[model samples]
Target: MTEQRLRALVYGDVDLNLIDGSAIWAQSMVRALRAAGCRVTLVLKAPVRTGRLVDPLTELDGVLVRHPHAEGLVDGDAPMTVPQAHAVLGRVDGDHPHDLVVVRGRAIAAALAGDGAFRNRLWPYLTDVPQNLAGFTPEIHGDLRRIARAARTLLCQTEELRCFLEQTVPEACGKSVLFPPTVVVPPELADPAPRTANTPLRLVYTGKFALRWNTFEMTGLPTRLTNAGVPAELDMVGDKIHDERDDPDFADRMRRALESAPGVHWHGGHPREKAMAIAAGADIGLSWRAPELDASLELSTKVLEFGALGLPVLLNRTPMHETLLGEDYPLFAASEDDAVDALRRAAQNPDLYALAAARCRAAADGFTLERAAERLRAALAEVYPQPSVAVAGPPLKVVVCGHDLKFFTRLLQHLAALPGLDVRVDPWRTLSEHDEERSRELAAWADVVICEWCGPNALWYARHKKARQRLIVRLHRFELESGWPQKLDIDRVDQVVCVSPHYAALTAEATGWPTEKITVVPNWVDVAQLDRPKLPGARFHLGFIGAAPSRKRLDLAVDVVEELRRRDPRFTLFVKSKLPWEYWWIWKRPEERAHYEALFRRIAASPSLAEGVVFDGYGGDVAAWLRRVGFVLSTSDDESFHLAPAEGMASGAVPVVRNWPGADTIYDRRWIHRDAGEMADAIEVIVKGGRWDEERRIGQGQVRDGYGLPRVRDAWEEIVRGR
Candidate 1:
């Protein structure tokens, strides 16, 4: 077989051999490349006297250089007074020529690429480096900006980094490729099975000795596993390097936590292979990271390595794994109880572990060295694919306006993602008492004015303009519900778009405008590629997928679930909404927050609703939960489109919507029924019938065809272009 030809140089300021996450990261990438038949070369400014090569011993396999005087330095920039560091890097660039030299540190990487010779070959790879006021020194900022502009390519590990880079250096970020964290699993290394029913299960955590790594989550989990007659031992490996270790005072709380925790061993630090071998022997590896860290949103190398070693991995519910991996995995827990349950389940079901191992291997292959190389080469080849001709005219400058800040912000993101289209969003979500001044200022600068629920402001802009460029006003549920017309000057406005025909009808009725003047552009939920996994025996589960108290009517949902439970003791209600756990102070009083907590507990405890009422927590994955239920219910008092039911219907759930005032008097009556009673009846009927799944499948097809993104995008384009 022919060898896959590619070269990678892993250079950074941190000691590559240090027993830490950074060293593990450097090792994984290098090992992955070597396994894929790539000509791998690594460069590090190691300590002058005892410069030892890091894990995988790739230094010996490839090329290793030692810097005599660069020891004990955190930075490699000579301009910053570290002369030996710069000398070492300069020497590496001259002697060992390669296809790509991957630099990790921001400043040093930028400084290296600043040289014309290195600029053509250097690829700056950002490993989720946090940018804060403390770290934002003038030199660091300058080098980052330089690297952002000069490097032939930039690689980011997470979406957060991509979002951050776009804000910092948007133009340079356009050339960047998001190469998410991955693992390389050799067949021999990954053959070990997780602890089975006959033997004690071994649980492991191979990460830095920090609370942020969520060592605390593992505290009580081991107890649950042990109580279930599954002997569970939790072993924690990989402590902070000597210099990198924080003060003992930093872990004061952890010390207290360990006092009460049992069957948990905190091994300070160990060699790379030792840690990996220990991990390979474990049943499951914990990779629960604090969500606050933007870098943690990507799958950690620890999680990947565990999978590479063929251990069933346990993770918290995070975007980190979801975006890269699938929904069905061995374990995903948020709290201690959930951790216990997941642990016990994994311990009992060896087959589940085998399934997870298979998926993990598949995931590992998806992010192999060969795949990473292909992604890099493909991105580089297309960096500047367009010809350098200057005959094209200036790009269109578009300005979108909306009353609700969040609504406008989401719209802005959507517009920004559209390439070759110059778009600027004037977000007036924070309209002060002096909004008139602000609106006028923005009005003058805008070419195309998109007025969305901007009531008086929209009217003001309409009265001021003669529709020279374009003036569009979008009517939402609030505009119709409040009995307020779109409030735009019809003579000056070029287009009027209602989120739904019902909203448009309400506006037309109030304004005495012709129906022809208003265009119906329904809101859409993008579920083209959502995972709609069917849960076994999920027939009696009722799902409500929204957070707002008014729109969702949680109290009404509770009543409905109580009514259902009275009829069928097996019925369960799954309320999928994110709790304000981080911002509990907003509840005003302990009693108020406690009341909600009790409500959640009640739902979780009921045999019908307890395990059934999974607080699926905030975000777009509601589709997954929706598929597990026989019926989808929404008791919204009012809405423009009521996306929850629409989304639920799209996920193969039988939608039961309440008949609101807007639904009765709005445009058409295709979906909404009378009330929650009617919704409940519809759900009961679906449960009684064995055709609920088939019905929902047909409905899903209907939603995809009618209210999909492309359909909505087309309507939006027509409205904006005055077609």
Candidate 2:
């Protein structure tokens, strides 16, 4: 592949300064694309501000650079608006379709989605993901949905980020590919300098100096190593300083550390090559960051750079890092003390240093330019064969007729927007009835009729459905016991959808429905909408949806919280739901009122319970509301799907489920408890034993993979399309 071939593909990024990690990635990936046998239309976010940093990749083989000739509005000076960047994309790909167009930035991704030009060939390489609960707002959620809806594939920088993305935006679940950071090893560093005895153990850090980067703490390394009987020196090569917003003196302190700390040399800043040259001479790289950054799903590019130069990296022992360097890697550190011990041990032992270096080299092998090129090439090629086909034929006539389309709306919207499907909704007036005139009109018009609930609407469709029209009726928990399924004519319906396998089995047994006709499609949790990082001290906050209607067993959840607070008053329960009095039907019932009255009296009697139990009323922002909850309690008497636990799991909360009928089938056996006491036992063990975060991730993985909207949508689509 030569420079001529690069024109078939395009690469666009939002950053124009070409400095940060994202810029570094662009430089590396462009080279990988060149090697992958595709010439590219390199679209810059802004016009080249100077000749000094005009990316050399623009002049590479098979490359065409598109600079915004019309002076676009520059942000302050360097960055261009997303509109200008998008305009560049439009100009380059006008009418004539390219093989692929890779873009970046959430804003530009949104723009590309709205432009509707590169519908099928767009690959968005994303970074700067939301790190907190408040970040995944409704607007942000819509932006992600648009991106997912537009792109053929999404590229993530790390596996962890991809997992988070899937949970955050389920539509991107199967489409996302790992496009991890790549390293360009300098040829001059082909052979790493030997760390011989009597020579100072050189520790180098190359990046922006920041509190979270632990650059200030890095200055203390040389002296601490010297105190341990091994003389050391520190080299830092970055000019940018990230000041903590709340800490005005942080930069001053960092400057003092770099200037006055013993045996420390600082190179203000240099080009990538110049910086790598300094790092090449070092024996080890310093990347042990602060605890705050440990929660990040991104991989450290510094580690890859160091490893590319055959140097071991001293970094935090995060799961991603551990997987990269293994459990036995000598340089993994958790605290300042661990860092001192690890560095001292590596300095004293040549064998351990050599081992870490070798392991680091091996870990970095898969991230080289050659490997990345191969992966990128294959990903592009895979997409090329299955080109986006426009909605060609007559739209598949679909009518989703039901009273409660709450669960069906997400699927309906997807179907309505699909290329080949013409979808409509014929909502029933109530659970068992619809307007006779409108219902008759819809039934005749639809090629496919979906009765969302197996209620009266389904019963009517089962008898009246045309032989040619495909009728799909879904059975829920209430219908199985309400005699609706038994009343319907079984042979007319093409498919019977159940939310869970346990319910499907019960439906088959109790209603005598044919086993072969029923299929289980679990209720979806809008993972991306629900899943966000937990709030501060969420581990101590237990939560449940509501206490109303009695069967939900809100009192049992209070019991668990009361039990936990007995041992540790720090534990608290947040009830984010309407009370019995809020619902007239529930409040009017003498039995329901009595149950809540007794429960309130008990809570008022105990000081711990009074303080620990809090009723945080219903909020439309379920996604953000879940952030305050660490342990989601599901102590219901019985349920078909019990959506709360799944939503909680998606939101990075550990679930404590009562062993209601089929609860084990819906959730992992570990989360299901026999009683309130056992639920409290599980919560205490997960929290006190320091496995809450781990459990949180596991829960997210489970929900994201199994019950995410994409999975459920696919299952429903297959049945609807007769695939």
Candidate 3:
């Protein structure tokens, strides 16, 4: 095993047998946490019947699902209610408690947040949180404060909710992390491009068939739109119908309408994926909720699912929706009349569906399964911090040999501080050669030797290392193309680490090493140290960290800044990197010198870029420097794993990356741009609009989820310990 598997206990108060949103959320939460490398033990709040939803979760490795009734927590099929479940919390905790306890109910969270056993390992995510000043009573504030102060993180479903929590409960200021409405996107969309408007425009709604969901009004769409000369139909998929005392006939009216309506179809109920497929088959998605929910800050999961399937959604024109889909979104509806009118208008102009689809696609990209996994991964990192080692026996001697340890410095320090080992370094003079006497002395004394780079240092160790020693090699971007990996005797090395999967495969092909022998561990970013509050004037400031040797594309950044300033003169570009002259290898080439010189001339020649472009001196205090940056740019032609932008994101700056290969996999696709113009366009929308605060906060969580130091540090230590 690799050190120790991350242990997590997830308790969501919902019946997993149903297709409700809360039920689906529990299922998706389990999947996301498992994807983040957790060995989860999920406890159900209610008894299972068909166990349909639990099937998918059981298929996942390192996941254990526990039923409340089967465990005797409840008498029979009766639910283990909040208080009932709270009594058995210790039983679920076991002898050695799970590293993280995720409680989903507000009352249960308040009950367990300050418990001695849970300590700082409890992560509480409540949907019933008060949203405004009117809702935040003194008693409620006290309850929220107790939970926030004791819990590791207060998970929020929307930025608006997070802001409200911070304002209403002061203790939740730094503890809140956005866990936005998560959706499972189809691997390939049913339709990539929008189809021209046609007759029988199909609209689909999936979830509870409730009055507030406006499903009853949706049945009238076909009649109203057909009379308006645009034929339409409605597909309603769900089984749950609440019995309201105030509105006793709501369900009966819905059933009679479905049975008698000309074009409305009712699918009883289906699993999440099946329901989504049904929605994907339709022309438009119905998410037009009642006016009562408009003041709520939570984002709609159904809207995200519809968008994930590439369907245009009909939603209420609330502030939350406006910020997500933009104010110009064509399908904003407030009532049944507004919805019918919007559909009629869209049918007349097919281009509106195309625009709506684009907007929906953009907004949904940030709430995907991958993004959810990343967010969960980051949240878990806080609960399981890197531990300072305590020696149990004779220290195991370990040494790191490399010419450049700049990238390995943080990791090296982590190992050196561990109490179990006597750590040392054998710094090589160059890539291929080392001081033979010093290297030999270290090799004899070391039980584990780590080659920081796949250069001569690794090759030499591969040929001469003792049989009992465990030698590990780490390969980077340059080593793959430089032919150094092919020279190493890979059989001698215990493991070869690569920064990414793309490079890992390339290294395997180059070395003919066994596929199982290689692992992809991303470079670590110190998220805890880097994440800080943004400066006051940072809204207009753009930052680019390494613009050197022409490939980093200083010219392209200048072009983007020029376009941005033309639209808004408040935009500025701050370039933080060493000048080209500082690198002798780059300056020795005349083309490199000419490229940088020309870029400098262009920036000075342009009226907009003259004062707008600032070149700050390079320094190690990047976290401190990133305070004044609002946006971080990656305009390079290519990259293996760009830590600069991840570092920027860790420091609460939005990332604006060029669509390099696999760029979307590393970060959210919403941040990746096709060209300099698109990058500028995206940035302008944030600065000129009201989404900067929310956008940067999400970025901060995204980067930590991807490459935070603790997760990577754990992976590296396992390789070193040969576990």
Output the lDDT of residue 622, model 3.
68
User: Compared with the true structure, what per-residue lDDT tens digits does model 3 show for residues 1-723?
Assistant: 125777888987777777887888888788788888889989888777766678878788899987768877678677777777777776889676987788787888887865777867788887878767887778777778888878877888876676667656766755678898788765665454455445588888888878788878888989999999988888888887767676899989988887778788988778777788788888889899899889888888989888888888999998789878988999999988999999888777878878998899888989888899998876665544444433366878999999999899878866775547689999998886678989999988889999999899998887778989999988888888888888778789888888877777777887799999898999998886567556567989999998786888878888888999988898999999999999999999999989988888887888889989998877655665687899999988888788888988898899999988767657788899999999999998997788998998898888787798877887777777767
Top-scoring candidate (TM-score): 2
Assess each prediction's global lDDT (C-alpha) against the native: 0.62, 0.80, 0.82
TM-score of each: 0.52, 0.64, 0.58
Q: Is candidate 1 or candidate 3 better by lDDT?
A: 3
Per-residue accuracy of model 2 over 1-723 as CA lDDT, tens digit each = 222343444555644343456667767767788788886667666656543234576668677666655434234445557776676677668866676778767888888888777786678887867865567889888888889888888888876677667666767855677788999877888677777677888999987888888889899988988888878999988766767897789999998888889989988766677788899999999889888888788898889989989899999888688778887889998888899899888888889999999999888887999989887876655443211233346778998889988777767766765556778888877886678788888888889998998999998877778888999988888887787888888889888999888999998899787899999999988786576556568999998986778999888999899899988899999888887898998899999999999999999999988899998756445666787789899999989998998999998999899999998888999888899999998999988999999999999999999999777776777777787
Error of 3 at 683 (Å): 18
Q: Name the best candidate (by lDDT).
A: 3
Backbone clashes in model 1 = 2
Q: Cα deviation in Å at residue 308, candidate 3?
A: 1.1
Candidate 1 residue spans exceeding 4 A from truth: 1-15, 19-181, 186-392, 417-438, 481-487, 512-516, 526-559, 570-632, 647-654, 659-678, 681-718, 721-723
lDDT of 1 by residue, 236-330 (tens): 77555222254455466565455557887776556666677788877888876555543343457776778778776777776556544577665
Where is model 2 poorest over a 10-residue stretch in terms of lDDT?
382-391
Candidate 3, position 318, lDDT: 86
In lDDT terms, how accurate is model 1?
A: 0.62
